[model samples]
Target chain A: MTGRTIRIGAGAGYSGDRIEPAVELAEQGKLDYLVFECLAERTIALAQARRRADPEQGFDLLLDERMRAVLPACRANGVRIVTNMGAANPASAARAIVRIARELGMAGLKVAAVIGDDVLDQIREQPRSLSEHDGTTADLGDSVVSANAYLGMAPIVEALAGGADVVVTGRVGDPALFLGPLAYEFGWSADDWDILGRGTVIGHLLECAGQLTGGYFADPGVKDVPDLARLGFPLAEVSPDGSALLTKVPGSGGRLSVACCKEQLLYEILDPGAYLQADVVADFRTVRFEMAGPDRVRVTGGSGRARPDMLKVSIGYQDGFIGEGQISYAGLGAVARGRLALDIVRDRLAITGIDAEDLQYELIGLDAVDRTGRTGIEPREVRARAVGRSRSAYAAGRIGAEVEALYTNGPSGGGGAVASVRQVLAVTSVLLPRDRVAPAVLYEVA
Target chain B: MLLRDLAHVRTGDKGDISQISVILYDIENYALLADRLSVEVIRRHLCALPIFSGERYELPELGALNFVLRGALSGGVTRSLALDAHGKTLGAQLLDIEIISIS
Candidate 1:
């Protein structure tokens, strides 16, 4: 048995996450790997839109800035990179990384791009039943923009084994991004369900980066987290046995405690026992955490079952346009005036013969956040907002136009009127047979 | 006293479903939370939403209650017209549930 432990750092949780924290981890964390999980549910679909317009530009918009900022430090510290910033185009993203590395004067950087997650043609051919919605892909029809299956950690493990310094992939499972390194470093086999499950727990805890380090844990008096502006991302020191010590950089902002870990454990999860991932059905129900030090927590006791037979696919379709407008009112009777403004817009939208499918009117300061009806408190200020969705952009535009007209038409003390309309590239899910998604990896040397 | 006094909640969303985990600051409060905080109780508390259904899962050792609400986000973040489309503030709102007659 080896007494060695690998230190892994989570750089960014989402695509547009702050880059400074990642740079800090690369330079100062003394880590073996730095992983960035950038894609959200709808991000890849949006990226597909960009790709259709221009093939070379479907990757993350911030990939250039992120690579330039972190590459130098990562090269110096011998820290490898794993990320899903590839979005809709992993090959293009990998090529871009090589170009950035050459420009940074770091030559011979082995970059691997994992492709074949794009299952658009396959999904179109099969027209499988949607996982969440009632209908199948056929119901979506021509409005379907993109479809990518959630790839597993196998291609990533292969990429690392091939001596790739950076592994960029498209739509793989989020936890699998972190699990790849663990599987490679520990030599965990495909059938090692227990170890993989525990590793997945570590991955889930670290995937969101700053969330484990108190990014969202602050309250005025309760759960107060200091220096949120410079919040440090999370890192895990995992042994071959699957136990991990979760902590953050010393002298960094944010708190790393058991409370924060517990919150992240259940984030976006439905069944605690059955967190169905691409590689395994991880059971986090038995997971436990303890305070190891001032900014360290020891995690243990998570297990898993075998992998699923089917792979989940994210399908993005053109779901019409949404238009919204907002106007603020302040001073005495601000709530009343805001309410009146919303009422006028509501009536105006109806009077204008708006062809909106759905409409919502809200008083921002009073009931916007909770959606639990009016709070009934007359605050000093309020913003009236009107939003609607329609099949036609012109019809959606009318919803906002009615609210903007309220400045000259109705409601006293109205100010800061703004309106806009945009296309909604909405996303849904479908299940595909595992064999359908044949993941392939391509390497680029810089 | 309100539930916020004894616990903290974190809200997460996937599609139209919202997941809120209510974690007690102390494990001693686990029994109280588990006994009083039922799916029916939470459904009643959040009656204003267009929620189709809800399910509650309890983690005793962790002193947490995980609630999954279907049809809560009004079509989730990508489609919802809500100012806070992800329903990120739903955790804070759940904290407003008053834990009555705790002696």
Candidate 2:
């Protein structure tokens, strides 16, 4: 049964995705492996910085909560777990999981830790001008927060092969979490490009836990999804050759349709023919998604190419500080008052010689970030917002303070004044020689 | 009418780039979106934003068009000071674009 097909359930999509559905999958989905992909582009960097601050930290914030919620159920059902929730500190996370398993009386549970993605020192050794063409890459100095490479499925497959009840990883490609178990159970060779490619396409679909099951596909009347409050996460039934049936926990809320499957297949892929990852270049050009049954889609015809020689690294650095202030205007001429409020803050920054590196002023309801939602008509109320960026947090705080001062000194009808200042952890991409970095694994049997 | 009238959107992000997929409910609208959602048209429609370059890859079998908008994230999720760091709303913004029906 394990050789021919394996059932895998997506537990959590991101670090903070809903977990109740994952518990449902563990209790009822009959999954062989439950994969939780909780890492994002910036999450690992933030996690690494957190680890630097203190030991026994730097894991996913909800790690303990998620494990406590689902570990007992998963152990009772004999369902193994594979996850990239270790974030910046896989060892610490693995140690904690060992403690949790012992506490839950499942002392035999084996958790594997995959590490060596961190390469900040390596990045600083060979500094070069960033390749991002945007103006934002300028003025990036010596303050780097974290540098971690996007690891592949090699170490994870090793853990699964070594009889690990749970595989913990940090900074792996999203699809790698799913592909590792698929590769291990199916015994597909690492160099098997076609199977790996097909597996990656499935991993991509399942990576964003509830996306394929209709969590993000709902609209009021145009694209309606029913009972979304009880939306179920996705699970895949894969054959040895990488052909799979995508479905969800039966009786769950969301609808699984061709639209959801197709959108997910194309999500985050730059070129369908050349979706580059550390393991293989997944090609989705010839893939197909057909309705196999109700709430089930059959996926097939995926292939891959040779792996890239260079691996992309996401580097996090202390970029700057952001200061923001918002004040709401209500009454007959709220739009005008909101507009005037923004003007006052913009002029106040200049008049006070606050040389903020970048500044933006917006009428909240009319325009937020881009020139979006700008209709000719005016609403009864609008919030005026001003954001300033600077090298110093104090200077950034001053920009927001100036806007707050208008609450008492000026801007009639202004209420709900708020201001905030926060440090920015900026991210950048650089290519590292693939051979220069390696993924190593450690196992802890409770 | 708006693109959202005929299709739904899904978003993904990579550094400074934002990828939005416009998937039509009915496969019949594939030709319409393929014909209308061109580089020049999208560039012109999204001129207000700081888009350095745009690439459109069409999947006829899936009935979808994937747009990779470089420099769309206002720098990036962590780097950008924008409230919506990941440019999660770009797909909604694209859906709001006026589509001249190919009927």
Candidate 3:
């Protein structure tokens, strides 16, 4: 069983990613599994808020639509599904998928929900030490919304071993979604650090889906890519030795070359020699990409050491609120009017006595991105934007109100004035002992 | 000549930190990029917001330089009020750095 190669395709990189590429993968990419890595750093915390509002509704917002779009093709192609789109509630997400599968006339579809990642209760009982910042759970106080431990591949491997046609997970490591299936297929032991490390290299490369296939690589005249508007997602064909050829579906609309692979190899990673994951601490120092064929890149030389003892947990809390307002100016001297508009709002914010933090006033087209103010050529149009973070929602609302008031009270030709406010959900990191997390797998059969 | 003439950049974010990888179009120019694109040069180029700290990693094999900037996202994507919360545009901004060719 371990001798045969297994093919895996990345369905979605993150939540709210496009759906068509995933559908194309299921229909065309001949694969054993299609993994959708959806959850982001603060995604689960916001999902917890949705869960609080309604017990049955904390999963990915596009879960229903994505299932409806991909399930038909997956069932026909014999491609199993794995995803962390379950977000805050994997059980509910599993139930939703089972319902969709049954509706598609595929009855008796086995879906597994990987639970126990939500360790809010564990943190509450023993307040784990913070990792990224200098504080404990006690310092977070009542503002704490959610705390989820980043799970590893064991639970997912267990789910796949139990014959789960679909795996819905909550807060697992992004790479674990792909690594679990690889470990299960190859029978790679958990202690097999080097092989697991190689598998992680593949996981990290394909987790972002289209990023590996030139979707994010196009730079117009500088680095041209063909048919990028309908860019293809990535797939990897892995052998038992942990080596893989990363490629995309035939006739797909994106360039898959060594340049794309090289960029993705270092994406979001700090130290290439020791890229840490729950399953393995992968070393990409000697990793190399060789052009095998069109849209095919052979990846090798990935190794790993032992896994870390502590698991990283993302803790979400209500930080405060953010208020923002924008007004556009057109024709000549638009930059001047936009600057004047920002000045008016800054003065008005002080006069209104609103306590805010991290306040910024920017002219959108001129100096918002290039902060050095070195762009000598003035644009014919510019937008004035004022933003601030405040302790209260009411105070945050005033920042936008001040900008809106500029429509009538301040600069002339300041049109398209818009203002809005939202409560801020900030996330910080904490580390918990591996034994502290109890990962459980539950099955839902359609 | 601008750095964009010889290199391309891609930015990634985790919390409040931004990681940018500057990959050269040609492997031969790695030494020049490694010499000119120091941590201080990037700090000065991005002086608008005080980047709390930065670290540069050299990948000579891949002809790439990876720079990790801390406290750069205005408190990160979850709570940052900036329109571009992910700092996706920072890579493009860094391309403006002028490279004094030593040949």
Top DockQ: which candidate number? 1
TM-score of each: 0.98, 0.96, 0.98
True contacts kept of 2: 0.65
**Distance from true location, Cα of A209 in model 2, Å:** 0.3
Order the candidates by lDDT, highest first: 1, 3, 2
Relative to the true structure, candidate 2 reaches a TM of 0.96
Q: What's the TM-score of chain B for every model shown?
A: 0.92, 0.89, 0.95
CAPRI quality of model 2: medium
- Candidate 1 Cα deviation (angstroms), residue A348: 1.8
Tens digits of per-residue lDDT, candidate 3, A268-358, equal: 9998888988888998877889999999999987899999998999999998899999999999889988999999999988888999888
* Model 1, residue pairs in steric clash: A108-A446
Pairs clashing within candidate 3: none
Interface RMSD of 1: 1.1
Deviation in Å, model 1, residue A352 alpha carbon: 2.1
Instruction: Report the lDDT of model 2 for residue A364.
Output: 78
Better of 1 and 3 by DockQ: 1
Model 2 achieves a DockQ score of 0.65
Higher-ranked by lDDT: 1 or 3: 1
Candidate 3's docking class is medium
Ten contiguous residues with the weakest lDDT in model 2 chain A: A131-140
- Give candidate 1's root-mean-square deviation (CA, Å): 1.2
lDDT of 1 at A216: 85
Best model per TM-score: 1
